[model samples]
Structure formats: structure tokens, C-alpha cells
Target: MPAIEVTSLSKTFRTKRKAAGLGASLRSLVRPEFRTIEAVRGLSFEMEPGELLGFIGPNGAGKSTTIKILTGILFPSGGEAKVLGYVPWKQRRQLAYHIGTVFGQRPQLWYHLPAIDTLTLFGKIYELDDRQTKRRIAELAEAFEIEDLLETPVRKLSLGQRMRCEVAASLLHKPKLLLLDEPSIGLDVVAKQHIRDAIRTMAAQENVGVLLTSHDAGDLEALCKRVIIINHGQIVYQDKVSALKRSFLTSKLVEVRYAQQVGADFRIAGTETLKVAKERYGVKLRFDARITPVGKVMAALSAAGTLVDITISDPPLEEVIAAIYQKAENRE
Candidate 1:
């Protein structure tokens, strides 16, 4: 059976609407206006054992709501779903033993206590045997490379260190599935790599199925084999990560510093000049790699002026996602 399964699952929230004036706010205190918002609209997907799937969407696009529903934090408004063979909202206590969750913005570790303390506390909450908890803690500390920081106070640990511990704490009970929300947000490159490596190791060694929600494309590219993108509470694209990149990631950005001044009319075919600092002899250009070969663009720029420095890079992941969203919107 799939680790997670959903069939036309949906959620709607009732929210109070307040008008924008002091008088309106005061009047609303007596009787509040209400609105119904559909946070998730008939979404359906499944995750197999040991699968690393990327669940992504723009802000307010229902990613969090879907995760919350699956994790049993909230009940869905309609349809059916199953996680680890249990209805999350109906059997939340039973399901809790089989799943792990890590929210980047929310720290589960006690702020003033050492991570070890929290780990022990979670062990007792999960009813893990004392001996088993100690062994699991040691194993996780090694896997996450947090053995040295285990005794350090949560408040004193660096963000990266604390995040590593947070993930470790979540896995003390050896969950079969993991729900990760922006696990790499606000992390530096090195720190992000550490967390990614640990997650990869856990999935490989424990065969843990991961449903990951992250804005960082690197995380998806590095860890996920499949990706599902949603917009306006509906899926816009779902495919292998490789296929998504091949279909949409076609543009490259190039920056060049010329040794000699460039003329006002400097131009090249299949490339658009994004910026030019005439005084400093610098120019920025963008082109579709699929339409215009990088070599040809470089050759044209090189011939135009003596080059002091040049750098070429792929377009940011945000732009690629935006283009996908635009394509989806246009199709609708």
C-alpha cells in the first residue's frame, strides 16, 4: 500500500471579515461578517514507500493546508484521505506513531533547555523504552552530525545546528513517513547541504517516504525524484523533477565586463541586453539556452569587445516557477 493516499481531498475555512475603518471595526465587534475560503480544492495524490516527492506552490496556494490535513493538524472539509493506512483526523493518535513532521519556522525544541532534554522528553511522550530511546538518540545524532551539539542549549545552538537537532528529534520513534515544510528556509549553503545530506541518508537507510514542501529548488533537485506543483488550490504540473527542469528551465543569464567601452547599439541575435553600465564597460544579457547556444552568445560578446571578465548562470528557480504559473494561468 502507498505510504500516503488522497482521493479528491479538500478543505474550506470560515474566516471573519472586518472592514477597514475604526467605526466599522467597532460595529463589527457586535456582529462580525464572515467569508468562506477554500484552502484546498479537491487535491489528490499518493506517495509510495521511500519516495521523495516535492509538493510546491506559490504563497497562499494551499500547500500548507494540504500538509496540515495529512498530518492530522486539521480536518478536511470533504473527500477522503489515508496516511499510513489510517484516516489522519479520525485516528490521529494512532497515526502519530508512524509519521514525523518538521516545520522550519516552528521549533519544537525547548528554547532554554539542551536538545538532549527535549529528546528525552519526546521519548517519554512516544512511550519509547529508555534503552531504545538512548540508542535511537545516538544513532540520529550520528546520522545528522549533531552528536557534538546534543548537549548544547537550544537557545545557544546556531540555526543550522538547531535545525539538525529538530529533525533528529522528530525521528526518535523511527517514523515510516516524513512531512517536511520549508526545512531549508533561511539556511546558508553549507547548512542546507548538511540537512539535505542527513535527509537523504535517512530516506535511504530507513526507507522513509518523504513529502517535502520547499521553496528552494536545490532541495527538490537534490532530493526529490517527483514533483507536484499547485496554484490557486489546484495542481498545475506534476512530473519527474528532471522532466520539469527540461521543459521549463531553458534560460541563462550572462554578465560580461569588457576591457574596452561598448557602443550604444551593441546587440546580438537571440539574446536580449538586460543592463549596461557604459562607464564601467559592464553588460548583462539573457537568452534562452534552447533557442540560442551559450557558445554562440559568448562568441558574439567576445568579438564585440576585449573581455575583462565573464560569468554565466542559470535563471533563478523563482523565475522558472513563475513562468510555469503564468503558463498555467494562460491555459485557464
Candidate 2:
């Protein structure tokens, strides 16, 4: 069975609108105007057990709202949803036992207290016994490389250190599912890689299904097998990461080296020459595989000279996401 099933989920928020003038504000207090914002709209999707799913979107795209709804933090206006065979809104407490969550902007740890203290508190909340909690903390400390930081006050720890603690705390009970919303938001490249590696290791060890939402495309590429892209509170694209790349990540960067020096002008038909080596034996270029097939490009390159070395790589995922959003906007 799917670990998560969300069908026709929707959330609407109402905010009181105020006018410019003081008199208008006073009058609005008596008869206030309200603006209805559709944060999520008829969203439908499923996640299999032990799958890493990426839920991504621009700011205000309802990614957070959908995650909150799934985790039972915010009740949706209309929808039927089941997470781990339990309806999240109707069975929040029961579902909490089987799921973990991390929200980037919110700190779950005590500010002045050590991270270990917060972990202890969570252990109690999850009903873990003292020995079990200690063992789990030790294991997580090793996995996340936070054994030395656990006793340090959360406020004293750096962003990366604290984030590692936050994730470790969420896994204290070994939940079957984890929902991470921008857990690596403020982390540096090295720190981000550290957290990603730990998460990958733990997910593989425990078979935990992860539903991650992040602005960082690198996170999606590194952690998720499938991706769901949403914009303006609705899904625009949902597919396997490789399929998304093949479909929209059309552009490719090619670096080629010939056995000997070729002419100064190193160019190829249907491909844009980005740069040529000063000695003129190597060239770098780009092309859309959709327009000029890989086979054709390779054949053309071989025809130019004896191939010594060649590397072909796709454009960055950020570009693919941007292109998808722009295409959606153009359609609108």
C-alpha cells in the first residue's frame, strides 16, 4: 500500500483586508472585507512505502500548506487524505507515532538548553523508555556526526550543527515516514552534503519514506527518486527525476578533446560552441538533445577528429525547474 495518499486536498485561508485611510480602517473594523487565498487546490498524489519524494515549488506555492496538512498541523478545507492508513486530520495523535517532521523556519529544540535535553523531551513525548532513547540518541549522534554537539546548548551551535540535531531528534522513535520542509535551508555546501548523506544512510537502513520540500534543486537530485513540482498552489509536473531530466532538461554540456590539434575554429553543426582550448585540440559546447540527437553529435565529433576524451552532462536542475515554471506561466 502507498505510504501517503492525498486526494483532492484543498486549503483556503481568509485574511481581513484593510483600506488606506484611518476612517476606512475604522469602518472596516465594523464591516471588514476578507480576501480568500487558495493555498492548496484539489491536490492528488500518492507516495509508495520507503520512497523518497521531492515536493518543490517557489515561495507561496502552497508546498508548506500541503505538508502541514499531511502532518495534521493545519486542517484543510476540503480533501480526503490518508497517511500510513490513518487519516491525518482525524487521527493526528495516532499518526504522529508513526511519522516524523522537520520544518526549517521553526526550531523544535530548546534555545538555552542543550540539544540532548530536547531529544530527551521528544523521547518522552514519543513514549520511548530511558534506555531506548539513550541508545537511539547514540546511534543518531554517530550517523549525523553530532556526538560532540549533542550536549551543547542549541543556541550555541551553528546552523549546520543545530540542523543535524533537529533531524536526529525527529528520528528518535524510528518513524516509518519523515516529512522534511527545507531542513537544509541555511546550510553551506559541505554541511548540506553532510546532512544529505546521513539522511540517505538512515532512510536506507530503516526503510523510512521521506517527503521532502526544498528550494535547493541539489537536494532533490541527491535524495529523491521522484519529484512533484507545484506552482501557484497546484501541481505543474510530477514524474521520476530521470524522466523529468529527459523531458525538460533537454540542454547538455559537452567537452571534447581530440587526439591532435584541429583548426582554430572548433565548431559543430546544431551545437553552440561555448569555448575552445587555447591549443585548439579541445572544445566545449552545448546542444539540445531534442534538436540534435546525442548519436548525431557524437558522430559529428568523431568525424572532426580522433576522439581522445569526451564528457556529456545535463544542465543544472535549477534551469530545468525555471524552464518548467516559465512554460507554465506562458500557458497561463
Candidate 3:
């Protein structure tokens, strides 16, 4: 059986309308207007044991709602979900024993308490024996490089330090599955790198199945092998990371620099000419997929002027995701 399986899962939330004026409020006490919003609509997917998948979407895209259902924090209005051979909502207590969750915005540690204390507290909550709990805590502290900061109060630690502790607290139970919701939020370059490295190591060494949700493309690129993209409460795409990139990619941008800014009107033979914009430093060319070998484009540009620097890149993922949304909107 798959480690995670969600079939036709759906969740709906109801919002009540409050009257603005006193008289209207009094009237609303007798009868109120309520609207039901389908936050998650018939979403389905399955993950094998030890698979690492990136779950991504824009705000209000049902990513959080799905995660909530999978973790047994919220009951789904429709469909079925099973994690580790147990129905998540029906077997909440049993499922809790096999999963670890980390949400970036919330810290699981007490403000004035040292991280070690928090881990110790969680060990008791998990009903872990002293020896087993101590061994796991020691190993995690060393692996995450938090040995020096374990004694410091959470409120006094830096963002990176606190994050490492949060991750450690979740893993004290040695859960088979890890659910990360924006684990890299508000982290600087160096701190993000540290967290990403730790997550990768955790997965590789422990064989933990991970379901990660992050807006940071860098995080997805670094850790996830497969990506599942959601939009408008639906699963629009799900596949290997490379396959998604190739299927949705529209154009490639190349920036080339010459020793001197070429003033002559120049064009590459095989590529769709997107018109060159020349600045004092270099020329930027936007090309289409019809462009033959990138090597040919490079050679043609080199012939025009001494090539100083060259970089070829894809369009940003945000843009690709937006395009997908627009297409869906047009169809509707």
C-alpha cells in the first residue's frame, strides 16, 4: 500500500454574513445569510513509501486545506484519505504516531524554555522511553548543528536556530512521514541552505516520506523529485519536476554581452526573433522554442562581436503558473 493516498477528497467551509447596522444586526439574529466555499474540491493523488513530493500553489489554492486533511487536523467533507494504511480522519490517534509536521509560521517550542526542554516534553507526549528519546534527541541535535544552541531559550535564538529546533521537535518521535508547510519561510540565504540540507539528509538517511508545501521555487528545486501543482481547488498538474518544466515552459531568455555594444541590426537565422534591446552593457534576446541548437545561436552571436558573457534561462515558475490559471479562466 502507498504511504499516502487521497482519493476524491474535498472540504467546504461556510462563512456567515454579519449585518453592519444595529437594526440589521437585530434582523440577522432571526435569519442569517451564509455562503459555503469549497476550499478543496475532489483532489486525488497517491505517494509510494519514501517518496519526496513537492505540493505547490498560489495563495488560496487548496494546498493548505489538503495538508490539513492528510494530517487529520480537519475532517474532509467528501472523499477518502489513507496514510500508512489508516484513514487519517477516522484514525487520528493512530495516525499521529507515524507523522511529523512543521509549519513555518508557528513555533512548537515554549518562548522562555530551552529547545532541549521542548524535545523532552514532546518525548513524554509521544510516550517514548527515556533511552530511546535521549538517543533520538542527541542524534538530531548533532545532525542539525544545534548542539551549541540547545540550551538557549527559543525567544533568544536566531531565526535559523529556532527553525532547527522546530524541526527537531517534530522528529523526536521518529515518524515515518514528514509534512513541511513552508519550512523555509522568512529564512535568509544561508539559513535556507542549512534547512534544505537538513531536510535532504533526513529523507536520504531515514527513508522518510516527505510532503512539502512551499512557495519558494528554490526549495522545490533543491529537495523535491516530483511536484504536484494545484490551482482553483483542483489538481492541474502532477509529474516529475523536469517533465512539468518542459511541458509548461513557453520561452527561453538569453542575455549576451559583447566587448562593445553592437550597434548593427543583427538577427539569428533559426530562432524566432523577439527583437533585441541593447543597453550600454549588453543585448537581451528573447527567443521561442522553434530555435534550433542553442549552439547555433551562440555561434551567430559570437560572429557578430566578441562574446563577453552569455547566460540562457527559462521563464520563472510564477509566470508559468499564471499562464495555466489564465488558460483555465478563458475556458470557463
Q: Find the candidate with the highest lDDT and give its number.
A: 2
Model 2, range 82-139, lDDT digits (tens) per residue? 9999899889999999999999889899999999999999999999999999999999
* Model 1 Cα shift for residue 281 (angstroms): 4.8
Clashes of each: 0, 0, 0
> What count of clashes does model 1 give?
0
RMSD, one per candidate, in order? 2.4, 2.7, 2.1
Q: Which stretches in model 1 have alpha-carbon errors above 4 Å?
A: 257-261, 277-282, 298-310, 329-332
lDDT of 2: 0.94
lDDT tens digits, residues 1-332, model 1? 99889999889999999989999999889999999999899998988988999988877889888988998999999989999999999999999999999999999999999999999999998999999999999999999999999998999999999999999998999999999988998999999999999999998999999999987778888899999999878889899988887788778889999988887666889999888885859988999998898899989988888999999987776677878889999998
TM-score of 1: 0.89
Q: What lDDT score is found at residue 219 in candidate 3?
A: 81
Please list all clashing residue pairs in model 3, or write none if there are none. none
Model 2 TM-score on a 0 to 1 scale: 0.90
Q: At residue 43, what lDDT does model 3 achieve?
A: 93
